[model samples]
Target: MQVTTTADPAEFMATAGDWLVREPVENNVLLVHALDPNGVPPGDREPVFATVTDAGAVVGTAFARSPYRMTISDMPAEAAVALAEHLAKEGEPVPGVNGPTGAATAFSARWTELTGQRVGNERAQWIMRCTETTRPVNPDGRPRLATEDDQDVVAEWFTAGMRDSGLSPEEILRRTQHMVGGQIANQRLIVWETSAGEAAGAAGWNPPLHGVVRPSGVFVSPNHRDGGIATLVLGEVVARALEDGADACVCTHFLKYESMLAVVEKVGFRRLVDVVEHIYE
Candidate 1:
């Protein structure tokens, strides 16, 4: 297998767009940042993209932005190893890897073998997809787009939801702002509010790609945890996603979050795959 690397974001998208689009939900995070059509340029450290070809056909792809996790498609073990070795030799400091569990493990192991950096299983999450709309038995509120005034609250909730992650507070704040801002700009950040004008919960979906919309950043404040507020909010988001022309609505929640998992399942989302994040210092 041969891995071709590129520094030009446009070139990488041109080369891997079709491949990534083929499995939009499964590759949602990668495509959203890599193909960022919002005219956002790469940060101080340029993002790197790679395509693994075997016998003249692209078999896998990867994207790595410094100080952030690297993401790869479900590639063969050999291809994973090749990509790892290439990144290691190129002196790329891959803080972590995220993708299909098997592929991620394969790449993480190879990176450890090559660079002597120990790998830790950071987290695992389930990728769920919904094709039909679902509604709570007794929906309490309607879903609406979040306004700019809601930014601070939305960012706070997002940051709180990420508390268990390894990101420093500063990193979390930056990421939350970027994510929430993007969702707001796209008018995709949805808020479910009570009749009393209280925001009970919120959820958002990435801009649709290849007919698929990825549900993300679903969170309910601690005070609103009970009474199935999350279900009503997520159900509305999924239903709207379908009505908005998305052929599928996909999402990921930590495997250990049984409550969220049940909510998604109750909303007609079928589990597709388990994604694991492997981190290396």
Candidate 2:
């Protein structure tokens, strides 16, 4: 019934983590942020975390850092509207909203109504989960754990992905530098290589949370497209997670990435939910 904001990730998790885990696949993003020990990485934009509570129980949750859209799990439309009002009232600059279909739409509409901003673009994100991964029978490349030597290229590719999402340069640097290094250090980031030693593609899985591991930062080199590199790397990573005891492997991708969709399906992924990201003008 009331919206509250915090700077503490611990508080965010303490309040919202239980509700978030109720739908792990749908709330994977927030769960990652909440569980991340290396929080925010000195970004240019301040971090924001909020939860809607009624009688001491969390009912809705959202998190944001400027230059990046606010992200939430599924929540009541009224809860989403209250979140928009809370952010707007705080003079927080919300460039967009991303979440489940109804929640995202409600938040965007409320944000626009309060701020007089126009919705500019929208993207559909598919949350996919794979329990049984089908690796390439004869992949063009073989999977290997990334190393310090591979850091720059992996960071570069991930930054490019952040750019495509409209992230500001500073925020992109904060995220990729911190994220890529952490993933590589943990040996979770994997690169698919050609017999000739070319890095054809890369993918990584987060630490399992609630028995679910989300594979992310997936990318295939431009020259490697259509050679099944994405599927090769992703399948290998998810298969390893499952082998390591992950109950399910989840990931989200833009619906516009037709080729990636095909790759995911080939790796035995099926849709779990449809999410939306709405940008403002």
Candidate 3:
């Protein structure tokens, strides 16, 4: 097996796309593609690496977008150990993050073996899927799609959502434009308003693919919390997704979102994966 680096984002994305189309669930190609497309340019960004066998078959791949942070799709235990050792020898400060718990644990263990840094506690990520339809009963307000003129407000809300979720502002902004453009193309934003025509809460969903759509930026202002505004916002977004032919919709919430969890559960969403956000220190 040989690991090679690529500087062209387009080529990397193409290769990654081919890999994903062949093994969608196994490789997490969609998530990586989305991140890469929305990521900032590699002016100073670390180069991405593709792993392939002697026969030129791609096996496992990883990329270091930011210094001290690496994201991997898959890797064997021995290859992971080798990667860790190589990074350690180069004195690279690696903080690993990814979906595969086994690979992550093995990599962390190997990193410690080489660098003497202990692994930290793992946090939980809940991947929730929408299973049933529960439209909001109180039609006290109408849902309106956001327009291009609303970019400022939308950007502010997006930044707030990212900050609330502990994402980097620069990275979030780079991704937000892509997400917002998608929202506009799909007419995905829904705003809950009061009888006075004031915005109470808002939510956005991307276009459906493979019968699935993921909702993003579900938020209610502080003054509007606990009044079922979030529930209304989510209901509108789910309804939109379903109307667009989505058989299912997904959203993620950290373990801390007790209220959000309850709202999603009440609306017929099921928990799928306990996702963890592993940050490199």
Error in Å for residue 235 of model 1 = 1.1
Assess every candidate by TM-score: 0.92, 0.94, 0.74
lDDT of each: 0.82, 0.83, 0.63
| Worst ten in a row by lDDT for model 2 | 36-45
Please list all clashing residue pairs in model 1, or write none if there are none. none
- In order of lDDT, best first, we have 2, 1, 3
Candidate 1 on 1-281: residue-level lDDT in tens? 98889877678788777778788888876777676564232344777888888987778888887767788888999999999989998998788998898888999989999988887657888778889975554546667899998888998898898886567787777778888888898898998888777898898777777788877788897888886888888888888888888899888778888877888888889989988888887
What TM-score does candidate 1 reach?
0.92
lDDT of 3 by residue, 43-132 (tens): 245555544334576656666554324666555666666666665765655655554555566677778778766755465656677845
Question: Best candidate per lDDT, number?
Answer: 2
**lDDT tens digits, residue span 81-123, model 2:** 8888988999999888888899899998889999999889999
If both were scored by TM-score, which would come out higher, candidate 1 or candidate 2? 2
